[model samples]
Target: MTRRTVRIAMNGVTGRMGYRQHLVRSLLAIREEGGLELEDGTILWPEPVLVGRRAPALRAIAERHGLEHWTTDLDAALADPSVEIYFDAQVTAARAAALRRAVAAGKHLYCEKPTAASLQAALEIARLAQDAGVRTGVVQDKIFLPGLRKLKRLVDGGFFGRILSVRGEFGYWVFEGDWQSAQRPSWNYRAEDGGGITMDMFPHWEYVLHELFGRITTVQALTATHLPQRWDEYGKPYAATADDAVYGVFQLDGGVVAQINSSWAVRVHRDELVEFQVDGEHGSAVAGLRDCRVQHRATTPKPVWNPDLPSTEPFRQQWQEVPGNGEFDNAFKAQWELFLRHVVLDEPWRWDLLAGARGVQLAELGLRSSAEGRRLDVPELTL
Candidate 1:
């Protein structure tokens, strides 16, 4: 039997996510896991070639990973017959054009989210990939997250019987890019660069809501630029043209109301600060990045609310910590492995370009809802 190895060309290898998430964690780390086994017991390994604009950065990354193939020319990598898959981790503004080129070159695509800056662009890319008959996927990493997966399990197990509503609190104060040294790239604060909390986070919530709950049918949103100006990495001030905080209400199928607050201004105050509180008819569940807790009627005990009472005994016993069994891989890396299997072994990967398009649709609708101060019905896209 021939040992099948999928050769992947990674675009934007120098970027933060490209380096840490995709390159190191996903490709190198997963490769070091003795490769991934397919359902048929066949093993698949990824051979990644780092592609970026900077030679020094690319070389440094390649050397750090003990990889020999590194190049600054995208066309050269794309033209290589050995490169069967093209992965894009470029900026949102640059993703469409690059992916289009890759698709035209007949390489399968696995790209970062928002697939494109706008819904139209996303749709076009999806159409292009479909027309070419090439395998394609998007990064819907949150769906693979351990906490979110556990939440899905509870939802599947009917733990939250007839979920009534979902409340998501996601975000932490991003460094002001000044004396604090920004946690994110400077472009993320600018609208022209397709950087904003809404654009960055809505796709994640969309997948989470749709996968764990149901599809969103309508959205009413209000966005704010709380910090009009922010400092860059060098302490240089730049106008924040995009929203730093976004509040949106999504009405899912079956009348499930999901209210999401995604912000860059809030401080991290609790464990698994990014939480999803789901209330149901018989029970409620709260899931975070690290833990999940539930409160069912069977386990709930009647308690009196008192301001001066010591809060040690009543409800504390009711709350149970979900176990962390060390089976959870980084979200991005898990998605990467799934995509690789999908491309090589024909496994079903839900985060396709169409799913990505739907996310962009929701973001666009949210922005329109904010601008018009009216609820917008989300249109379904043909996959």
Candidate 2:
């Protein structure tokens, strides 16, 4: 079978997510699998043209991946008529300018979110793409996870009757780079560098909540900088200006309440780095990255409030495990395939730059809510 290639000028491929998830896992994995088969049976292959600021990094990545195209020049890459898509995985501060250039070049836009540092920039980029008549997509990777997919299945299957509330816990102890090197980059700890728990995580919560349950109508948030001082990559002590933790409550459209706590300072006691528990009249489900367990009302344990006695029931074992029912691909890779199909085949794609702007709006509102120490309404955005 013949393969139809799509050249993607993938910016920021040297970064952790850009390299590992997008390039190595998604595009390369798709290539390894003989690419995506279209309706006409031609395999659609993604050829990544690695773009970044550093020539050595770009060249090294291209050489490592056995990729032929790479450049340190964004303008030159955009000028290439054959490059049909531009994928941005750069830092939040650098994303807007790169996206604007890409949109102007008439390339299809697929990128990581929050698309820009602020809602205005995000909306502008979305509008630019729309005006250019380019197909666009944003990475809403969490919804593609096996656990969330199962959760969505249950929701669509009506397993949860009259859904009531949701609780989400997401965090891990990120090393402060004092004794051990920080797992994440140092820029993530500085507000001036576009770093904050609210900005980093609220967007994720926005899409996840809106998609799985209902659109979030309002949000109340409390943010904290748990660690005031942290050592950077160079072992130099820097004041951590960004909020390391955020506790937020979201009111969805159907009066379903959702509370999510996101923190970089917390130690994990759960099975996964992130988890969500959804409760409804009929049943309740706890879903992690790869596992989802549910307890129907009939099987739910009745525990009377007793401060005098230790729990006798095995609470964790009571819920039934939700099976995959099928093989699951890497979450990032799965979304990549969908975006590829959208671009190459003009298939219906829902998660676009507009959706990305909504995520950004949520983050911005979350910050404002925290600062004002009050609840805030989320207004709808129009292009």
Give candidate 2 misplaced runs (Cα > 4 Å): none
**Cα lDDT of model 2 by residue, 55-160, tens digit:** 9988888888799999889999999999999999999899999999998999999999989999989999999889899999999999999999999999999999
Residue 161's C-alpha lDDT in candidate 2?
A: 99
lDDT of 1 by residue, 224-301 (tens): 999888998778999999999999999999999999999999998757669988999888888887678888878877
Model 1: residues >4 Å from true position, as ranges? Answer: 39-41, 303-317, 324-326
Best by TM-score: 2
Best by lDDT: 2
How many collisions per candidate? 0, 0
TM per candidate: 0.95, 0.99
